[model samples]
Target chain A: MSVDTASAATTRAIVTDAAGSSSRARRGGQRHPATSFAGIALRTPYWVLTAGLALIFLYPLIWTAISSVSPLAGTNQVDGWGFGNYATLANYQAGI
Target chain B: MTATLHPPASSPAPPEARGARRPARRRRGRRTHGALAGWLYAAPTALFVLLLFVLPLLLVLQMSGSDWPLLSGNQGPNFPENYQVAVSNRFFMDSVIFTLKYTVLTTVILLALSLGLAMLVQESSRWKGLLRTSILIPSALGLASASLLFYVIYSPIAGPFADLMASWGFTFLGTPDGALWSTIFLIVWRYAGFYMLLMLVGLQGIPDDVYEAARIDGASRWQTFRDVTLPLLRPTLALTTVLCVTGSLLAFEQFYILTKGGPDNSTITIVQLIYSVAFQGPNDLGVAGALSVIVLLALVVINIAQIRAFGKKAED
Candidate 1:
C-alpha cells in the first residue's frame, strides 16, 4: 500500500539505475526488473552477507531450543529424554 | 437540511432519491440504535477493564493507605505511614537510580540502533523481506521467554558461548556492570526488530518524492537523514521512546530470571524492590502498594513530560 501510494515521479529512470547506484538515497527507487543473470549473480553476496547476519539474531534461540532437550547438565531431564523435564515442570510450584 | 436533501424544487424527485431519503427523525432514531449496538459491542471490554484494571488499581490505592499484610490481609487504615515507609526504604533510591540508568541507556541505544536498522531495511533489495523477517523473529517471543533464553545463554557453565567467554575471561553476570550490559544486550537483541518495524512503518510513510527531491537538491546522505527523515520520524520516535522508557522503568522479569537483582542487588529495579517488599523480608503489602502508587504517579508524570516535549518539537 505504501509503495503504490508513493506513485509520485515515474521513477523508471531511477529504478533502472539501481544497478549502478550504491548510495542509501538512491535506494528509494528500487525493484527494477532483473535485466540479466549478472545482476542476480551480483546480488548473491548481499543475500549471503545479510542471511549470515540474520543467523546472529536467530541462532541463540535455536541453540537454546536444541539444548533444552539435549540432556544439559543442570536440566531436570530425569529419564534421559522425552517429557521428563516437562513432567517435572508440571509438578513444580506445588502443581501450579 | 430537508430542502437540500429534497434536491431542486423545479425538478421531480428521482425514485432512487426518494427511496434513499434520510429524514432527521429517522436519522436520530438510527443514531440511537447505532449507539446501543456500539455500547453492546464495547460492553465486554468495559467490563474487563473494570474488573481487571480499575478494581486492582483501586485496591492498591486502598492498600497503600491501610496496613495490608501479606497473610492477614488489610488491617485498619495507616494513611501516610506506608508512603513514608516506601520513600524511606533502603533500596528505594538505588533502585530508582538504577532504573533511570537502564531506562536512559536502553532508550538511546534501542532508538538509535533501530533507526539505523530501519534505514538499512528501507532499501527494497531482495534481502529486505528476509532480513526483516529474521530480525523480527525475536520480537515474536515474550519478554520473559526471551529473558529465560538469555539466562541460559548467559550461563558460563553450559552456555553455547561459554568457551568464547572463558577464552576472554569474562562472565556475563559476574560483575554488576557485566550484568547490566548483558541484560541490556539481551533487551536490545529482543526488541530491536520491533522498534525497527515501527521505524520502518514511519520510513515507508515518507513519500518517495521527498527523497527524490532531496537527491535533486544534491543533499548528502547524512544531510537528508537529519533534515528530512529525522524531523518527519518524530512521532514514531516519541512513541518508541515512551514505550522503551516505560518498559525499562518497570523492568523485573529479566533481572529476576537472569541475576535475581544480584551481584549484591546491583540490578534491582523499582518493580523488583516493590516485589521484594511484598513477598520477602518484613513482607508489607501496604509498603508495596504505596511503592506501586508512587511508581504509577512517576510514570504518569514522565509520560506527560515526554508527550509535551514531543508536542513542542513537532510544533517547531
Candidate 2:
C-alpha cells in the first residue's frame, strides 16, 4: 500500500508539475486584463465596424414594423393607425 | 508486465516527443487564424440576411395576418379571413390559370430551343463565344426594359415583326392566339441563351475521355449522347426547368403594362389581379392579402412537387 501511494504521487507530480512554477511567475509579472486589452485593441476595429453595419441594414425592417403597427400615421398614412391597413386586407379579396 | 506491476521509468520520455507535437501546435494556430479571417469576411453577409431578409419576412407574415390599415388603428383581431377571401375570388382563379399556362409553355419551349442552340454553337469553333454572348445580351436587359423593347417589336404600324408578317399577309399581335404566341416567342428569344449557358456548363463538365472511349467501343454518336450526356445533364436540366417555371408563374410586368390583361383579360396574371384589386380597383386590401397568402402557399407546394417528381423520374 505504501508503494502504491508513492507511485501514485510520482505520477501526479509528473502530470501537474511542469508548468506550475512558470505559470505562477508569469501571472505575478502580468495580469489577465492586460492580455485581454491587447487582444481587444487588436480586434476592435473589425467588431465595431461590423456592429455599425448591422444596425444600418436593420433600420428599414424596424421602421416598417413600427409604422405598420404604431398609431403615428404621418403623411405616409401607413403609420397613422395601428394595424388598420393590415385589417383592410380582410375585406378586399379579389386577388385572394 | 501485469497492469499494476509496471514501474515508472526514470528516463525522460524523449523530450515529450517534441517533433510531432510542434507541427501540430503550429497547425492549430494557423487554423485559428484562418477561422477568424473567414468569420470576418462572412460577418457582413450574415448580418445582411439576418437584418434585411429574415426580419422583414417575419414582419410581412405578421402584417398579412392582421386587420392593419394604412391610416387607421387596428380595428379588430381578424385572422384567416383575408386568406379565405383571396382563395374564393374568381379573379384569383383566372390569374392562377394564366400564370400556370404561361409557366408550362415557356419552360418546355425554352428547354427545347436552348438545347438545340447549344448543340449548334458547340459544333462551331469560330464565332462561338460571340454568338453565346450576343444571345445572352437580351437577358441582361431588365424585365421592364425588355417589356418596352418587345412592345415596340410587336407594334402594328412600324414594328419590324409586323412588317415581316405583312409580307406574309398576316397580323402578329392582333388576335388572342396571335398575341399569346408573340409573347411566348419573345420570352423564348430573351431567355433561350440563359438556358443554353446552363446546358453548356453541363455539357462541358462531361470528360472528353468518356466520349473517346465510347467512340472506340463502336458506339454511335446518338447512342453515346443518349446514354452518357443526358444522364450527366439530368441535374442541370431539372434546375433550369424549375427556374423557368417559377419565373413564368410570377409573370406580371409585361402582361400588365403591354396587354393590360387585354383581349378580355386573357393575359392577366394572379399578381396583376392582386395588384388591381388591392390598389387600383376597389381597394379591397382584405382580398389582396388573402390572395397573396394562397399564392405563396401554392408556390411552395409546386416547388416541393417538382423536386419530388424529378427525383422519382431519375430513379426510374
Highest DockQ scorer: 1
Q: What is the per-residue lDDT of model 2 for residues B67-93, given as tens digits with 9 covering 90 to 100?
A: 755446345547776677666777777
Residue B2 of model 2 has an lDDT of: 55
Query: Cα lDDT for residue B126, model 2?
Result: 36
In the range B104-219, model 1's lDDT, one tens digit per residue, is 99999999989988887877756687788888999999989999888878989878888999999989999999999999999999999999999999998987667667776678
DockQ, candidate 1, comes to 0.28
Output the lDDT of residue A16, model 1: 40
Alpha-carbon runs more than 4 Å astray in model 2: A1-96, B1-42, B69-76, B161-171, B312-316
- DockQ value for model 2: 0.01
Angstrom error of the Cα, residue B295, model 1: value is 0.6
| Candidate 2: RMSD to truth | 27.0
Candidate 1 at residue A28, lDDT? 44
Instruction: Identify the CAPRI category of the predicted complex in candidate 1.
Output: acceptable
lDDT of candidate 1 at residue B7, scale 0 to 100? 48
